[model samples]
Target: MSLFSTPFDPARDTALVTGAGNGIGRAIAQALVGEGVRTVFADISAERVSAAIGASKRPELAVPWVGDLAELDACDALLATADAALGGITHFVHSASPPRREADHALAVDRRIWQQMHAVNLDAGFHLARELAKRLIAAKRPGSFLFLTSLHAGTPRNLPHYSTAKAAMAMLVKELAKTFGRHDIRVNALVPGAIAAGGVRRGSRAGAAHSARASRRGQ
Candidate 1:
């Protein structure tokens, strides 16, 4: 057997990963390319997308797409562009999210911030997944979708916008999975904990100090 193996078929699979310009999304996109999968690295920053594709194990297999997913128009554009670049996306990973600001706690966050959070995390995600699933179903092909949620979905992170969006996404996953399973489209969510990566913000002085201590301990 091959030392490294994946359920994916390099010859048949094409992937689209949102927020692939940094952090977990970046890592997942690179890993897919490493496995010989043609992957679209979608992010809001052109610079980050370029850097991510350059850093991929198979740069040639990585397609760069930059757009703000918070806007419905942009989300539609992303789907069109990805479809043009790669005929059908066999694997989808939604990891795009607005960067969390420490000051945007429940009491201090403005309406714009709250709406943007939901726009990117939940609205865009649902739209993309549903559109992709429709394509897969119409073509009679199987596809897989992965949503990056958070442990804060169940517990409070003091960032109500972020937590509530994630909580809704967790439910969205279940709903989509139940509906799509019969169509050979699998939907799932990945809940991650604190990691020293992009998108992670220290909410308070204590949290910052604790993160520093954890870093020092290599935790």
Candidate 2:
């Protein structure tokens, strides 16, 4: 056996992946199930949740959980449901974020839009990761957390809200990683390039919008 083999034994671990109904989150959940890890596909849309499960290589290991992570209550509900259904969650991936509307520019973006973005991308991440870490510490079990950030985080995208939220999440990743290392809990961020995922479908308006922004920024 390779000395570098991952300690993540899917057979004994359970994962909760947000935004799993589609896109990057969906892909991650599918991979986890393929590794024999039981996973919870949490999304805002029930239909999307069903679709994700249907597409999984091991649907039996995938549980559907519909909730709006942007809302604190929904986050609480998700934790309770996962506990009741899976007994415990040893892995977590926060990839749930509102769609990047082309209209949401620096000035055009309203307070509600900013709040929603932060609620899902920033606040929800902190709450969920912190709570899970607490549980793991109390139980003396190792766990892992992965947050999906954006390239726009370090650079300016003219979309202040999205970039700011992602930037904050990036820092949050470090903070969690440092604080939880002593407990054998891992925390990291996955910054992806433009992938043809559910959030920004190929040739979709959002993709075009993003491209336009990049072009303007001389990216």
Candidate 3:
């Protein structure tokens, strides 16, 4: 009998990535599929989901799931769909967040917008990670989970909704990592700078805010 021997074998890994319709999420899904991992790409738009899967290096290895993860039901549906499609999830990535507009600042941001941001970024991240960890523990398998947080987690970004949600996510990462470590499930946050992608556009006020923060740090 032959055995597979490798630190991380892409061929045996199955991943589910949210907000994979564009930008950083899209890039991560593509990279996973390109490495032979069966990746399930979940996004809010059917069109964008299709486009992301189409653009993947290995379309066959990429599965498309479109849903609004901000809703609890939608988040549950996504997990069910991934389980049905992939049998078992080995890698989980929560990168989906509502578009953060510059004009949507602290005083101007609507209450609903604040709730939506936390629902998607913080609520969904916690639910998804917990559910995935449950399955991995049940199957006695080791897995890795990554949440797409931001540098704004520690620094105020002027956008209360976005910044606060990210800050909460950062704490969630630490808590999950500590609790799930015994189960061999690793949880972490991928804090990214201002990238001119889907939601974080160039020349936007949010970008300017990030730049200002970076400058202050440098000083």
Residue 213 local lDDT, model 1:
79
Query: Per-model C-alpha lDDT, please?
Result: 0.91, 0.87, 0.88
Clashes of 1: 0
**Tens digit of per-residue lDDT, candidate 3, span 64-130:** 8988988999999999999899998999999999988777887898988899999999999999899
Specify the poorest-scoring 10-residue window by lDDT in model 1.
1-10
> Between prediction 1 and prediction 2, which has the larger TM-score?
1
Measured with C-alpha atoms, the lDDT of residue 115 in candidate 2 is 96
Q: Each candidate: how many clashes?
A: 0, 0, 0
Q: How far is 132's C-alpha from truth in model 1 (Å)?
A: 0.2
Task: Kindly indicate the candidate among 1 and 3 with the higher TM-score.
Answer: 1
Off by over 4 Å in 3: 1-11, 201-219
Q: Write the per-residue lDDT of candidate 1 for residues 42-65, one digit (tens) a residue.
A: 999999999999988789999999
lDDT of 2 by residue, 131-219 (tens): 88898999999998999999988998777888999999999999999999999999999998665553532256777777667657655
Every model's TM-score: 0.92, 0.88, 0.88
- All candidates in order of lDDT, best leading: 1, 3, 2
Highest lDDT scorer? 1
Best by TM-score: 1
